[model samples]
Target: MVATGWRPKAGNRMPSPSRLAGLLRDGRFVVTAELSAANSADPEATWRRAEVLRGSVDAINCTDNTGAHVHISSLAAAHLLVEKGLEPIMQLTVRDRNRLALQADLLGAAALGVRNIVLMSGDDVTAGDHPEARRIYDIDSMQLVEVAAGLRDRGTYLSGRKLEQAPSFFIGAVENPFAPPLEFRPLRLQKKVRAGADFIQTQLVFDVPIFARFMAMVGELGLLDKVFIIPSIGIPRSARGARYMKEKVPGLHVPDSLVDRLEKTAAARQADEGVRIAVELVSAVREIPGVAGVHLIGIKWEEGVVQVAEAAGLLPRPTFSPRASVGGHG
Candidate 1:
């Protein structure tokens, strides 16, 4: 179940799910892995990541310097990915960007045939490599949803110019199903819905029954049909990786049993075990009612994500490699 609560803003427009709902019906889960471009300016590495995902997943989600990890700009990656024939979902991070930059990126994504996007306030700048880097939160995630939707429907850019054709995108927002105060999860999601989010991709969800309960509460609010809920599953690799996630990432929790298993296993085999667990998680969630699909967060273990999707039967065997599509000047 999903919740709704978005309000119209400047150039007010009615909310609709025409874009994202179609992707959900397509039946392929959107696998979101961090693009490892060592340098944000290099578009080649970003293209390679998108190419690999194109072979294994239906859509590629690019993060805006996710957690300050190494990568290209989320918008750049999304643009390249769309050009490479894969669906692109740009992560619209409001933090560290001005209103103009946000507007440009949104228009850029739309121009490139990226029909969906995910809005996020973003992780603290301290979480990134350059701890001293400054941030510019000109608008929060909810405000972003309102602004993007408003502009898209009005057939004009934020600058008030007419478009050859108004760009349309299926907008989404993040949700944490395992919040400390579970009661607030529904209300919070409701706010995003009212803010014009067409879909929701939840934070790392491990406990299935708890997630189901959260879905039930969302249903009680009578917004399920109006919104699509896609839960994200993070597949852990090394002990260092698991530890760093649990201790460093906000709004993320790693279960003890899985951590114990990772600790007991050999370092070289940890990624394999982690992928197996992720496959199990996805398989279980597929049976739950009202679930749209799983969004896999592979971190740096991209190939392991392919294995997890294969194990979950989300990808077909003997997949074609998109090698020719990468390495060209982006």
Candidate 2:
């Protein structure tokens, strides 16, 4: 795959808002995967990832500088996916943009026919190569969710300015159930739902009990019906990769037993063992009471999503019929 750079499409608009929204509303177990680290050297980068995920995942997540490293912008990648006849869950992070820039991108996404936006606070600039870079968190994730909701639900900006056409956004927010003060995580999610998060995506979860407990609390708080929950599972390429996530990635945990299991396997077989473990984790999470679906992150190995989705029996993703174009940019 080659790297690429881009802006929004000139006049590409979809007939419907978001296919993921329709699937969640219909109670389908949606599958999604990250389009990993798209760079600027190749224009075909985004589609290459999407091609592997096509028909295997319900939607692809165009990440916004995840790990705080530079790449093709998430909005641009989302636009590429849309142009490819694929659905993208575009991510928006406040680490490098003020509210104005953030809101502008929200409008830009709507104009491109990209309907879903997941709000995030983002990783620290230190986590990336440019350690000295500054951050501009004009609004946190929850506040950003509120901001997107205003544009969609109220057709106005945070300044109360009106829009001729309101954006149709299926807003989403992230949570890490494995983080400390675990009990408070549910209460935190409660706040996001109140702020207008239509759906929830979580950080990588290796411990099923932790995720199960988190969902149980959400269910007990009456949050099950308010927001759809899609848990993320990160597939390590090897035992070394698994160890890195446990030791380096903040707010994520990799159990010793899992790592040891991978280590016991032959060197070349470790990758397959990791994938086997991921498939098992997917199966386990599927049995959780409130789960709407799963989001798999395979780093650079995009095909793993297809393999896990099929092994976990989430293949044959459903299709949608977008309504007649609102004709904004047909």
Candidate 3:
């Protein structure tokens, strides 16, 4: 059963809540995919990708200026996904916006029919191509959760201003269990939960033992009953890609054994090997007691997302209620 206060009302007359939210609330395993907005100004490309992923995954996540390299805004991309009849998890990062901008975007996104949102602190501009860009983190991701939940439940903004109508949103946040000072990771998750995170999507996790330890800690803290936990998994398309992630990415942890497996495979077959490894990870993660679901991050490898989900036995997604609110605009 879903924790109290998180379940959507059965009699809700609005478009049914997002399928992703409903599944998590019902204690059902879910599969979500991430779609990177193209660097170019073509919305069609993103829509086509969402079209291909249709019915294969529960929801598609639109990243917000990932790596600080500007692309289509996450809200715009999410809107396009909604137009295509796909459920979108709108990613909101705190790196580039102040409190006012963030609050405005939140309301605007909800008004445009986005129901699911993932809050992130975001990567520094130094990590992206534009090192000269100014960084503006007026509010971190943890606080953003509090603000969002206020808008949803209290019908007020962070400033205590009441709204004529509150937006119904399924709040989400990200976690990096493999990050340094591993012992404190679960505690960090607790903070997010306290701030009103309904679900958590972790960073790329290749070390099962480490992730298992993280989950164990979460269970110990009784967070397993508080929020849905979904760890992110990725398919390394090439040996070079694997190496870059292991070395360049700060919080991501890619096991050396997996990197070696990719190194031994031929370049042409590396993609297939990557998919196989991802499938194995998915199957393994599902067995973790507290894991509510899996989020596949198929960066630049869209087709692999389908293959991984299907191979991991996550295909043939459970039927969502037809009465389910299509999108929450009000």
Candidate 4:
């Protein structure tokens, strides 16, 4: 059974006032891990994976049709995590939903006690298994952030109608620091902050120096103080995996040096090297001035997250008072 007091009911005791938000506000280094929904109907595997990350992570991020492939809904997956006494960061992409659907889902997620949300303009359908699927772009991610913030701050919808009970969500947005036209990236982040992003999670960052430069630019613009910046860290399982990420994935910049390091390592030991690299990156990133946290994306290699967190000295997360309530319509 799930732990007591972690249930999403109104009167149940809360462990903390949203661990991610609290950590960011208190200037503490935060750690979050992504938990993608399984393609199958059974949730046992997903729950088991989440169980392993309980004490090591601050929040579990539920992906929304990641890579445009359909899976269990992110909202449903987040609800499952909540049932298991784990905090979930619900990801909502604008690729499939219109304004009405988005608003409805936001309200439903809030009712289910999901406190954090990551907004994105999802990957194109052609990139997924179902290339023939029709795409919807009713509103982009920026507008979605504005819409969510409007509900929280002003108790109103984008249409100017006031909400009787606005959903309180800790808004988040995704960034690709290694994306082309490098200089424009920080400007894009500033736009999201202006649109009301409470935090920003970046894409897989293998180029530490480039990411550091990006952070420096962000700090120069004074955007770091406006929003919590969490760089995404990935641990490739093999040299082939690293090569695929560097060559195939758009907006992902896995440096050639990392690839060479992985290639030179014995085939059996490549995974270990990946973990070491992740640990090194985490340690290096922790020293960077503007980084509020690290979001570890151990795609299919969940156990590696534990190894990286432990090796990087990010385990044994701080415990907060149970008196703090998480997400709700304020």
For candidate 4, write residues 3-40 as lDDT tens digits: 11111112111222565676555556778999857877
lDDT of 3: 0.83
Ranking by TM-score: 3, 2, 4, 1
The regions of model 4 sitting more than 4 angstroms off are: 1-16, 321-330
Candidate 4 yields a Cα-based lDDT of 0.82
Q: Lowest summed-lDDT stretch of 10 residues in model 4? A: 1-10
Error of 4 at 252 (Å): 0.6
Candidate 1, residue 207: CA error in Å?
Answer: 2.3
Please, what is the whole-model Cα lDDT of each candidate in the order they appear? Answer: 0.70, 0.81, 0.83, 0.82
The estimated TM-scores of all candidates read 0.84, 0.92, 0.92, 0.91
Where is model 2 poorest over a 10-residue stretch in terms of lDDT? Answer: 1-10
Q: List the residue pairs that clash in candidate 2.
A: 2-42, 3-40, 3-41, 3-42, 4-39, 4-40, 4-42
Q: TM-score for model 1?
A: 0.84
Candidate 1, position 326, lDDT: 10
lDDT of 2 by residue, 63-102 (tens): 9999999989999999898998888889999999999999
**Clashing residue pairs for model 1:** 5-193, 5-194, 6-193, 6-194, 6-195, 7-194, 96-136
